[model samples]
Target: MSTPSGNGDQTRRDIQQTRAELGETVAALTAKTDVKTRARTKATTAVGGLRGRVTEAGQSAKTRATQLARTVSQKASQRVTSVRQKSQHTVGAIQGSAKASAQTAGKAESSVVTSARAMSTRIGSSVRTKPLPVLAVTGAAATLAVITYRRRRFR
Candidate 1:
């Protein structure tokens, strides 16, 4: 009779422990099913994802901007170098033309001087050879010049 009573008491304790475990599991499941809490967790996850995407976009834009700036800078440098080279070439051409013109002018001046000197020598020799005839011709030329000048002034 005493052994049966002890077995009955042990069975009652086991049932109580099982009931306690079941209650805990039900509480845990109810908490998991709470709509507000689940919504809040989902919202938090979405915000974190959005933040990560925004950071990635910002980094990508920065990289593209840096690359564009480098490209523009390289183009500007090339243009500057090209313009400088062209200007140097133009200046060299102008200098060469100026030097050639100066040389041509110097040669023309020498030619004119030589021709004038030769003409002057010929006239002086001709005058000394026939002084009387030269004087008569000179007087006749002076009289004709006076008559032509008077006619133009009257008209």
Candidate 2:
């Protein structure tokens, strides 16, 4: 029932503080000694971080693939457009060439027809001017042709 001294109260407080500090140290040591729990915790954290990284990488790759596909499509479209333009130009050139060739052929055919008609007129004039010699030569040629035709037919 006697009142405690001031020094005794201070000592008691110090002892309680020491006991609290000891308890904290013991708890820290117990946590460190528990290897299985620490390892399990570390493994869970590593797995979570790795999963996040993998997911991020996958998303990045998907984005790149989409960009690549778009690039290829655009290039293909450009190439197609270029080919179409070139083909159109080539077709136009070919048509122009064909038209020029047709015109030249028409001119040549007209010249040939004119030459044939001129030769026919000259032959007619000659026959009319020399009737007796022409008849005699014609008679000789007809006789020779008949004789040759008979020989060929018999063979």
Top of the candidates by lDDT: 2
**Each prediction's whole-model lDDT (CA):** 0.68, 0.68
TM-score against truth, every candidate: 0.57, 0.56
Over 1-155, each residue of candidate 2 has an lDDT whose tens digit, in order, gives 66569878999999999999999999999999999999999999999999999999978965775565555555555655664675576556555655665577755455555555665576467558746444444544555565567569869
Off by over 4 Å in 2: 1-4, 101-155
lDDT of 1: 0.68
Local lDDT at 33 for model 2:
100
- Per TM-score, the best of the predicted structures is 1
TM-score of 1: 0.57
